[model samples]
Target: MLNRRQLLQNGLLCGGAAALSQFPTGMAFADEATRLYWFGSPARAERTLAVVKLFETANPGIKINSEVGGNDYWSKLTTMIAGGNAPDIYQLAPSRFADYARRNATLPLDEFLGKIIRTDKLMPNALKLGSVDGKIAGIPLAINAFALLYDTAIFEQTGLKPPVETTTWDDFAKLCVELTKAIGKPNLWAVGNCARYSYALEAFLVQRGKRLYLDNGQIGFDIEDAKAWYGYWDSLSKAGGCVSAEIQALDKNQIDSNPMSKRNAAMTIAFSNQLVGYQQLAKNKIALTSLPILEGSGQSGLFYKASLHMAVANNVKNPELAAKFLDFFINDLEAGKALGVERGVPLNLAVRDVVAPTVDEVSKRSIDYISSIADRVGDFPPQVPIGASELEERVYRPIADKLGFGLLSVAEAAQELISQANRILKL
Candidate 1:
């Protein structure tokens, strides 16, 4: 196999400007029909690539070279663009999109909306998530949300009533304690060690009507709010509300590898779309429950968001062809069937309706859960700032781990975390 530089050089030689300038960005490759490079994470690669394969079958002239951007996808992708090897279309998360948009790394897609891409079939709210500065920078890939997934068998066996939208945070914690006691397994617990997880943190903040950071890149919550957030989870850990740290430390970020898949915990927090992944590896039937409401608030921590996106690169050779391919990915009935809810709920209303009956029982459940909470979910938080990703590794992860491990008091940890957010965001 060719090394990365060689492979990248080969890609350029095969489809780069000098050779393919004749056809524009979307047409057939001069060598053997046009090749469009699509870079993204491996999280949803299997199902997404299936659709691309079908697209290739249908359009004999265009070939999509799907590649993994690996960890720190945005950082790596930016370097590639600087080196003049940008992918034609790529996956983007709303969190990092603003910085990319500001830098002009991605194409502004407003013009393609009703033309080559029929995003009019998508939910209005979903489309808004991918916009930056009032221009559509990316297409909403899937409208994802946060939820608590419970194993039905465990709840039945324990005689615990399943948690509902009415369940308070205190009530949920008590239920978790009860489940942990009932199971009595060394690794078994009721919740996930959700520290180091900004997604779950976002849900908690949003439930309180806060964002992680303001649109102007300022810290959004006070130190006291962070304290309460840490206190709640810390109390759960002390009460055996989540799996042992040893078990959680082994998490590989793959659904099958999670300790939850082995039923080590009765309940775990997950994105609504991830329920489909968890179902495959879980021995027991898993069901979605609304995130527990905070006491006296009556508001949920779950935030329905357009978590991921499909974006064409600023340098894509043919914008029209790229837009057409992307439209097919989201709006085509066949593509929708192949992708299902692997990337989260389909954002297109037409595609969602078409794939509803054909998807597996698990994916269908995911769709239904997301649909049921559509109105209950809060607004999408602002796009994370340029330093957000850096904060995760250097600042948030360390402080969160301290909270998770009981190495520091809640007040101390919260103060430190908030201080770090303020410091890094300014840098």
Candidate 2:
């Protein structure tokens, strides 16, 4: 493992003439490595490096210079782009994809698909999520949908029927209250308070025939929509159906910190693909199910999205080489085996099948769950508008936290969210 100084000394973290200067004159100048960067936990980074090694071994003479970023990834990436030194291949977040595309930071990949990159097995919705304004700006690495994941052991103990596809939010709340009462366990709640979760909020809004973003790049839903969404969890929390704010605050929403994984809650709202990781963290069996539908509204509002994407820089020095590496990273069976479902279910069906048999029972269940709901999911929503990430992580999350902590009324939280989101979106 290379430390920061070692990475800088090796030129992996440098660029251009400065980077060349870091290496021994002959060795570094000889190989024109296709630089790659991604931001993730250490585990995901290890899996990615394994795939990189596989790619290098399979295609001799083509070296890869890969770097993984930590907490400051987005800010650092912005700096790199501003300085005209972005990596040849990098991970693109769905929230920022359209923003990058509009800024010409990403190269259009329409020319590479089906030629350099295999597309026949890729899910159409995955490709759709990576595209902006009819141009394919990025290639999706995986596909995932929002879901309510619960502990089967807990449900059985309570003798409560677990939530299913057709379960309404009302029904879900009732079950939560009942589950908490029946369990009568200290510190354990029926469900985590997901009012602070942006994904859950999006799913709820979509069920009401509204979404986080409209086609025109404005905040889509209004105060009433947000009010109803928050009110659902708030009312449930008051009735002992959901964990209190203090308990919920212990979870930062990552797999390791999630309430369900911590045994502080029985159920949680998370992506379908996360079941593999969540199950590994839990002592008992965890299962995935559709998020409860809005009562009296026939809309499922479930959507399949690219969990993340791989994009080439618009100014890449070796476009063909970058495409070849991305093709191997995304479509190769060996890469699939190395990555498993860490990134989400593979977007490439053939690779998914190749990887499926190699994964554990929990991962296999994740693959099966995604397949079961794939046909019913709505189309990928509009490209997340610029500033939507800020709206979600910065504005929406804090406001939701405040609501959960009982620092703000439902109407107050709703108003704050809309006003802040609109201001960020410049609407």
Candidate 3:
């Protein structure tokens, strides 16, 4: 009779517990063995369960108790940690990791890196994404960057050439307008979306050689930067190159509701891993392209965002075993082959090479997409400031929604965002 929130808070879901009972390793492991609870989204269950089975076969003493928490994972994890019952090892988003690290709820992985973690096998940027305050705080499983995913059919029908390496943001916006007018469908937006919260805006700053927040715990970019970024998207929104606020609300921004999925949008901006999910929903062939850049932009604002991380909780009973399991998860070839970039492409270079041949055509496209702009990518962003999470979900997005809805002018929205973000971070 327990609801999802209650089940998640207790580290067990009703049907979820039943589902895990069916995993090959679920029931047989001894109680005395090391148990690690993994918090992951339900959408990630199938691939994660597959990886767990392989890990169990190779290492019998470690019993991984996995739960598919869906969107409740983070909220429940926060509650558990506050109540002194954090999961032994759980998946964390890079954006939220800092808040956890700042609170000392996450354990540092420095000692385990040399002994168990294969430091030489990971990209420096990949390694840094998991670090907070100079301490390696998590074991990264996969990395990705936002990309332009275009529907081949939509482009062909509209007679617009497919996107490529040199496509600038201006070119992309133009294409959006061209496709929308050519198709003559009011609902068919050119870009799936042109407005989003700080994550999307942060990409703009990165493109302009700025960060969202400086390491000294202050707002990273200027009012002009915010103005410019907001203005560009607002222009697209006003021109109908992007979906209107009402259409976005109707679609709820789900992949199924995206114009790209319905052959309505010629292109959409999304994380590389999302290409697979979008492909699953859309009948047309979906392909990945590098995010559009600014003219003369030296290196891109792009960095390999950690798709997910496995962090040992500070109160974990067996840190050694947790670290060993993490090392095995990342470094083992079989595990990599089993995962096959489902988690956002493997962060481990060795694993990438090992899993390369096994990927489906879509995954090969993603691998190629990441490699195409490899040299253009810039530095890892600093850890999110303490008030940053609130700034994103609460302050930033509401202001962005206002801009998209035409409720606020560019100057007004941009200033409000700058002032609010600065005040939040300064605290």
Candidate 4:
């Protein structure tokens, strides 16, 4: 009986031999095909499809059958893996990298890194993000840092100073209040309820020298930290700094639905790469700024994370072709120009340098913002544990919604959240 890794290797060699035999160089085989899967907005799908078309034109022998845009992407991927039909190449999030890599669902690309996939120009942190146990399971296509995106027009009109790198969370809340009062609009708000987001919560924890999960896969922060986090958001919500619960409930929690994007709020906490898409949706001029920090914290807790990784399945029939596509996607100047920052800043520094000048002002700012944070941001935290996503979607967001609606007090919400996280993380 072969183990999973051995089986994977066997599949690769046998599949490659069979594929190559059927479709020798000069002519394309009618049945040669591979699948690519990903989930994102229409803009992301458009940009990705554009690049896929380029890849196809360049590699006519290989055909890519693509699928995009589904709310149940992870669930569908899990089903595909179980059925031995995972996409040959897919977009993998850092949060789920450990889960797929540990299960041997993803291909290890160590053999191809320098030989097939170019990495000399790739950012070191971006490389680290796709690795687990020293094996490269994915190639980070782009990088993103946490940021506060605000409408510059709103700030200018209100005569308010936008958030700076040094601005504390306390100061951020006050600014929200000031902005809300100055605007004096019933429907419009200063900011969204950021506490309802896992990234925002993680940022808060990291600023205080705690992490969402420790290296050992246990819950990192204690009850006190949880209380402080929820309490802060609850206070902000009540103080009219954040959108009301009704308005927040209507939000679908994506780039298009975000308060700032909808023009219902002046600010939002979002990934640095999202500025481009957000700017397209928002009427006001969208600009990126540093996330509010914990006062006198040990570190800024801001770190560059792979927005998403391009991963090849371990059981892919055409591993070599997938590797080639990965190389082109990461290093090709034309692909980079087409992608812009919709997928976050390019992880390949050489590509970024060339692409930055050619992109829109919003995208250029995003690239510059990422560059400006090199010295201040901390190291990327550990690969989010197996149950981390569940904790965010199942435990964290629901509890945050309850707190926002005043169904649960801050103490109650914190206690419930911590207890659920501990149980889920097996701490």
- Scored by TM-score, the top model is 2
What TM-score would candidate 4 get against the native? 0.89
- For model 4, where is the 10-residue window of minimal lDDT? 16-25
In model 3, how many backbone clashes occur? 0
TM-score of 2: 0.91
| Worst window of 10 by summed lDDT in candidate 2 | 16-25
Give one digit per residue, the lDDT tens place, for model 3 in 1-427.
Answer: 2334654565443232223321232234344244444544343554566666677667755466665555555677777777776667777766677777878988999998878777778766577788888898887788888787888877788787877767788987787777788778756777755555466667777888788888886888988998888888889887878877765544444567766776556677778888878888777888887777787444466877887778888977778877877887888888888778667788778889988889999888888777777887777778777887788666776776788877899999889988888788777
Arranged by lDDT with the best first, the candidates are 2, 4, 1, 3
Which regions of candidate 3 deviate over 4 angstroms? 1-32, 35-43, 250-259, 262-264, 296-298
Stretches off by above 4 angstroms in model 1 are 1-46, 57-60, 69-76, 252-257
Clashing pairs for predicted structure model 4, backbone only: none
TM-score of each: 0.87, 0.91, 0.89, 0.89
- Could you tell me which residue pairs clash in candidate 2? none
Model 2 over residues 135-185: C-alpha lDDT tens digits? 999888898889899999988987889999889999999999999999899
What's the CA error at residue 272 for candidate 1, in Å?
0.8
Q: Pick the winner on lDDT between candidates 1 and 4.
A: 4
Error of 3 at 374 (Å): 1.3
What are the per-residue Cα lDDT tens digits for candidate 1 across 222-288? 9878888888877888888877666665655456656688667777777888887788777789999
Deviation (Å) of 295 in candidate 3: 0.8
Candidate closest to the true structure, highest lDDT: 2
* lDDT of residue 385 for candidate 1: 81
